[model samples]
Target: MINDTIVAPATALVKQAVAIIRLSGPDAYQLINKVFSKQVEKKQNQITFGYIKDDSKVIDQVLIMSFVAPHSFTGEDVIEINCHGGVLVTTQIISLLIKKGARFANPGEFSQRAFLNNKINLIQAEAINDLVNATNETSLKFAMNNLQNSNLHLIKKYRDQLLDIIANIEVNIDYPEYDGVGDVSAEELTEKLVSLKAEITRIIKLSKIGKIINDGINVLILGEPNVGKSSLLNALMQEEKAIVSNEAGTTRDIVEGKINLGPLTLNIIDTAGIRETVNEIEKIGISKAKNEISRADLVLIVIDSSRELSLDTKELLTLTADKQRIIVFNKIDLIDPTKLVLENFKNERIALISTINNNIETLVNQIMESYHFEELTKDDSLVLANLNQISLLEKVENFIKNAYNNIVNNYPVDIVNVDLHSAWYLLGDLIGENYDDNLLNTMFSKYCLGK
Candidate 1:
């Protein structure tokens, strides 16, 4: 049981209509009684209006709510004070609470306490953080689903299957002569393991899609000097984010912008034009552009249709031969339409557009098609947003595979149980059945204070 009371401002410490100051612990009621002037019976889950005072000085007119232990968020006596949303009022109330024997809550202390009190599992706790930081609707949907125990349901099903397998293996090892409990053949065990591995593999693939949903796709704009790279960036963003100029090497740094297409967010980067230059700053910019190219999920190679492809452009084409790229023929409005021959460029992933004329919707549609954005968003699958969770699942998959391999090689069922048991415990770690304090501390440290 927690002994000391903890207090924190649950709302932003800015001027607004109302702000919430939360307190949780054994002394929560006594601490509030010392400051609040309301005389209502301290009933559980009831809100009461009162004036907060510090030695006859009214701090703020507030509404205080009480939550009894075992039914509250943290399974402790909790008090939430809603006061005027001003820096001074919230600060003064928190200060008064601190002086009246309540300590400040650490980051994610409330959620950590909830986990300890069995109110929420580890997956739900992590989902809360995801929901708070979700950047798009798809991410929010996945986080909400996880918070509702969707992932827990799927994981529990797998865990139960593994547990049954282990139990049967144990029974065989302990009572091999018993006629009533028939032996589970090695072939039967391998088949079950194979099915489990397939399910886990499917989940891992879906998690990759989830990662993209949570973190926007990184795209790099790459080409030689004076190829309308900056212009293309401005067009895509529909704003003058990058400085455009007729002069070469005008953009000597990377400029970035983001756009949401359906549920996916495209993080577009406008980089310095790639070319040989004696200018030291231009060389640095080119180097940074190359680095960005290496990290990009998609590369948009802008080509000037008004001019023939230069030797530098050929070299760039050779360099990006292995990357997922779309060849953009910019300045089409300035070029003769009949002279644009398709026989020269063989790449199927190509687009003809003029940023000056504002013809970029087709290019955007091409990008969407390349990644199958619509199909990915339409499906309802359990997508693991956390890297640690995905890593654990991969480990579980590997263990299952190893067990299958051992069974194929005629290893004893008891020996195969070792890997299966390890897999089971790892799954438990994913859902907080088996967890370390250090892991919990690290996970909760990423959350905002008072969460």
Candidate 2:
């Protein structure tokens, strides 16, 4: 409820230079004044320096930022206590506030309140979360645009367009006598629906890239034993994350590490070498490796050029025949450097490198070439968000497609109106025009406690 005050640490409670404790609700100002040495008036956006005390005993010297009603975030009276970042001090301040009548805030309660009060929509609220956890510059740019309602604008635009069409159809159905009034022919209607669906399809394609950026790409390092698979993981991560062993079958489990290659982040998994082994644990590992290969976004088929392509190497190539893969000829340094001058490196899917020399730049660049993003600089709105946002968009796309099909099948214009309305509502769900408590609970629960 907005009437009761909710207080929470607005920053990580670790030992740092400063920690902020946020309070929001109707009685927020009143609750803060109860414990502070100095009184805080209804002065909006003013920072006051004061001492937090238990009667006469000083607790901590702090700075309080006061935000008065209706215009602040959450559209309620708000207060933020900026104190020393000692965990003990922050915890004490919160405890004092609780004793002074402010209850602890739930995870994402601040953003949730902002949504309920119409300060920001669902997509923008989600964008706020993404902004906090953004890994690289590219993702940060997308998150900032999302904060500015980039995705919300698109969803609202689509929703409004559908609503306008629905209203037009209703009017036309009710009044057939009116000449050139709400007059949308069946052909024109189908065309509009088809066009809308096509636009959504394009966005969905871009959204997959957004997902890869926000959630890192899953890359599987696969090969037979002694093929430098572990070496490849270590080289990419630039760390000794996986043990590089000369002994075959040393790595009998999945070893994972993450590395950001500019905009693209790869969750590299070094699995057990895929070869027939009699050992039960090694067999289990081999089975696990195969399972992971199915779900991998990209597979690095590492082959040791130091030795001849054995039957195991050929079988590895045959296995990843249709997968999105890069053929890595490891131990290229073992090849004559004079011969390297004669060979043309034209193939993007094939990389020749020596991890021993730490010369895997060709493989790294090849990865960046795999995803063709022709300068995502134009518009960030095309970038979709998390699974929830993507799934909702999928629903919108489906409804639009169904609407198009109904129109093409010569169904009544009103029948098309039904799907359009469903799509509009789904878009509303994306932008949070219509939603329930359960949706808010599930989405915001993923957010940080202080957020």
Candidate 3:
């Protein structure tokens, strides 16, 4: 609804066959006419061959496409110029558009406009950003599914179900005299609350799976000096990113990499070797290694297969006993693999690997199988994970749980309705069915210009 139109190059600023510059607002066509010298006498969804010029000089021969208001991405008149993708030509055309009264569009402004015009919901809009930022195939699939509108459709279904329950509650409250069949009774109210709880619980379960798929898992590798931690990391990454040496305490900092196991992203962190040392730098590295272990979703306690377990390994086991862990018996090249016995740490997930032998693929498969990463890939479609969505869903889940508890406690239905309403609104916010202007501005501000 701004007075001035905005324009930006829709394509990446790189060498390509053609670049597209998009303009939107009431002055879109006028700005196009000023910069582009061609008869763009085409209707909606039509492209016309044209030549772009600045005053008297020809900039480039181009094709121009125009979309009328309420029919384009921004729900306003929009013009797109398909110019040759040379940096100089594209820059000059943008400068000319500015001279013709067009301002530069902010990051995500076009998507923001689409949201403002009710062309797409907030969840779908967020999916677009997620799709662009996805780093792996799993992340890409989840974002694309969200953009497909199925997640929004499911959310709407849940919202409608909640509303129907709310309407039924009103019927009981407003018309107490109508003792019609299927009317609300104390027992009937309890049953309805139970059913609602089940429905909400189902959605909450899906959110848990969706969250893991969206955010992936963090796995930390911890071990004493020279235990092949870096070697394992290098093997997983399929590159020698970390310094591997026989010298103890070679790695004195955290090294990170991402490995895909089916659909799960393992943000693997190989930390400095944990060891007691007088050297100031190694001591600091050990401290950081412990800290990383404390924050990990999964911890791998790597032990040298040729040597006995040390005090550091024992202490690590005790500290991370409650966390999901894999006891990695590394250096199979130095061990008699046939004589390997796991009875000592029978309760833990174990993997025997040899980075030198490149025999760690079995370990990788074990890690995926132990974590449910394999099962997750069976269904690739999932919603994007973000703090807002996670928080809102947590609120909804807690409220529904509390409502179920109230029913068990024999609280009045009216009191329970408050929690149900809270749950409903929390889910509503995810889809922008309920949101404030400030929230909208903050979310869209993260987008790149011309997105």
Q: Write the per-residue lDDT of candidate 2 for residues 1-451, one digit (tens) a residue.
A: 5678899999998999999999999888888888899899998799999999977888999999999877788888999999999999999999999998989998998999998899998878988999998886667877888888755567667877888889889999899899679888888887888888888888787777777767778899998888889999999998899888799998899999988889778989999988878999999998898889788888898887777666776776777777888988888988874454313225428888899999999899888887745634345455775888889889999999888888889898888888888898888888887898897998898888878
Q: Candidate 1 residues 1-451, lDDT tens each?
A: 6678899988888889999999999889999989889764557799998899998999999998899988899988899998999999999999999999999998899998989888899888988999998887778877888788755777898999999999989999899889549468887888999999999998888777678668887889999888899999999888999999899999999999998767668899999999999999999999999888778878899989888888888887787888888989899999896798667568658888899988987788778777644434443466788899999999999999999999999898889999999999999999898999998999999998878
Candidate 1 clashing pairs? none
- C-alpha displacement of 386 in model 1, angstroms? 1.7
lDDT of 3 by residue, 1-451 (tens): 4677989999988989999999998888878888777756536888888788888899999999899979998888899989999988998999999988999998899999988888888878888888887766766766777777765766777677777776777777778787763355556656765776676565555556556556766789999889899998988888998999889999888889987766667788998888778999988888888888766877888999988878988888888988888999998889797877666897778888888887887677677666443333334333446667767777877887787788788887788789878888988898887899888988998977787
Which of the two, 1 or 3, has more lDDT? 1
lDDT of 2 at 269: 94
Error in Å for residue 163 of model 1: 1.2
What's the candidate order when arranged by decreasing lDDT?
Answer: 1, 2, 3
> Which segments of candidate 2 are over 4 A away from where they belong?
276-281, 306-311, 336-348, 372-378
Clash pairs detected, candidate 2: none
The local distance difference test score of model 3 is 0.80
Comparison by TM-score, 1 against 2, better one: 2
**Clash count, predicted structure 1:** 0
